[model samples]
Target: MSDFNSSVNLTMTINGVPRVIACNPADMLCDVLRSAGYTEVKKGCDTGNCGVCTVWLDGVPVPSCSVFAGRAEGREITTVRGVEKEATEFAQFLVAQGADQCGYCTPGFTMMVLALKRELKSPTETEIRHYLSGNLCRCSGYEGHLRAIIKYLEASHE
Candidate 1:
């Protein structure tokens, strides 16, 4: 294929299902994933400043927009939909705590929190806040999210 029309074929596992996608080598993972139907991977600040396009790449939380689709080949990609159970729980917690106001940034926040939970046993409030620093929530303040994370952590231990 000519350089201008070069399309790379990528085989990556998304949300527990293996998917193959063909796209330009320079296409960002966020665009590629959304095109492939994983709309849950929201596209906010495409510059990676807003963590709305967060996804778990090989079990590590990363901003999809900053990653190239070609780099994701042979990797495991987990969008918010992949962790339905956890995301749902986080959503419920957010609702209960009134943390889900605006809701646009919730998915990214949830994904980061889920990754934190998976990596840490019982993270402190400070740790949680520090870990989720990349995500921005302009509507509701972070108190509710902090409460929800603490509650979730407590419940997990019970």
Candidate 2:
């Protein structure tokens, strides 16, 4: 029998860097990443209702809080920091539209946006809203975020 509470080492490619991190089998990926100093992975609704702890798991956006750390072994994970250039560019639009409020959900939101940009060549407004439905922002009331995302997508295509 194996002890699930025992800590184990997992080698996961994080932000394009391979890192061996120690975590319990039961530990959530978000918690482990935060402990490993990836504070960008915020601790939100642990039930995966909130996308505040979103990260790229094998190039797909997933709620880290719902993922087991052990499952990430040998997998590629990309945080908002991994795509800093794109994140920064989007952030400018966010700021310009006054959508970068509180900044707690920015990282996860940015990750989703980056993925959306890569996945959708020319997403419609409905597609954009549908893609970002998982992420919630109380400060901006979503209007600002929608405006910023639309503007960012437009500027990026220009």
Candidate 3:
């Protein structure tokens, strides 16, 4: 009989849908997601240290770079591109507030913002900063980001 330890195809839920993709055991979630067309889940450091690779796995935000495709089997992965309602609000807010210059880090920031909005329907300025502490922005100071977040919360209330 075979050892049966070899890697096999893994299936997982991405953005509230099911996806069964063939991948090696060594393949990371980021790679699988990208290949499956969820390119929004970026690969920043690939070390799990940077929050850039963050994704909500069953409602808990985690680093996709550190996760294996098999590990994500049967789990719900929410990428920025998959969920656009909240994300669009964030993007619109960023543009209106002049926060997304260069736009390299907006995806990551948007993910964190989604998490914050889930937890706090309306977050204060300090709360926004505290929640977004994990995501790193290479350009544009936090002033615009803060403005965007605050404005989004305000709009949600109205």
Candidate 4:
């Protein structure tokens, strides 16, 4: 259609399923997911710094808020709600390590951790810390977060 940007059929594999959505071309992936009833995708800065809108775009962690819906026409968006297993496991680790305080940042941390785990499966504290520099935590002072992720990395491999 000539007015493709206004109303287009976009297709993407979200989490583990393929979905075709009708939306505006300029809509950010974060809004699309949230509008599609995936509130777990989150909406933070919407600029990419907060990392609160993090999601796996084509298997790589990305801030959905900064991504255009048109760009994800054929990509995959893995939100926390869809990746419950990994999120839950990470949540368990967060609890075990006493990482969670307010809990607003837990999902972002979980998504990032899962991505890191998939890549390294086991990373040192330094590596984990360096990798997570983008995500901001208001509670726990990152000490507990670091401990949990490291522990999760260690246990996920065991």
RMSD of 2: 1.0
The global C-alpha lDDT for each of the candidates, from Candidate 1 onward, is 0.87, 0.91, 0.79, 0.82
Q: Which candidate leads the pack in lDDT?
A: 2
Across 1-158, the per-residue lDDT of candidate 2 in tens digits comes to: 97998998899999999999988968999999999999988977889988999999999999999999988999999999899999999999999988878999999999999999999998999999999999987677888898999988888899
lDDT of 3 by residue, 89-124 (tens): 779988998887887677767888888877886666
Per-residue lDDT tens digits for candidate 1, residues 47-124, read 999898999999999999999888898999999999999899778877877787878887788899899888988887
In candidate 4, which residue pairs clash? none
The clash numbers for all candidates, in the given order, read 0, 0, 0, 0
Q: After best superposition, candidate 1 residue 16: deviation in angstroms?
A: 1.3
- C-alpha lDDT (0 to 100) for residue 20 of candidate 1: 82
129: Cα error in model 2, Å:
0.9
In terms of TM-score, which candidate is stronger, 2 or 4? 2
The candidate scoring highest on TM-score is 2
Q: lDDT tens string, model 4, 77-103?
A: 788877787788888888887776888
Clash count, candidate 2: 0
TM-score leaderboard ranking: 2, 1, 4, 3
lDDT score, candidate 3: 0.79
**TM-score (C-alpha, index-matched) for candidate 3:** 0.88
TM-score of each: 0.94, 0.96, 0.88, 0.91
Name the weakest run of 10 consecutive residues (lDDT summed) in model 2: 136-145
Model 1 residue 88 CA deviation in Å: 0.7
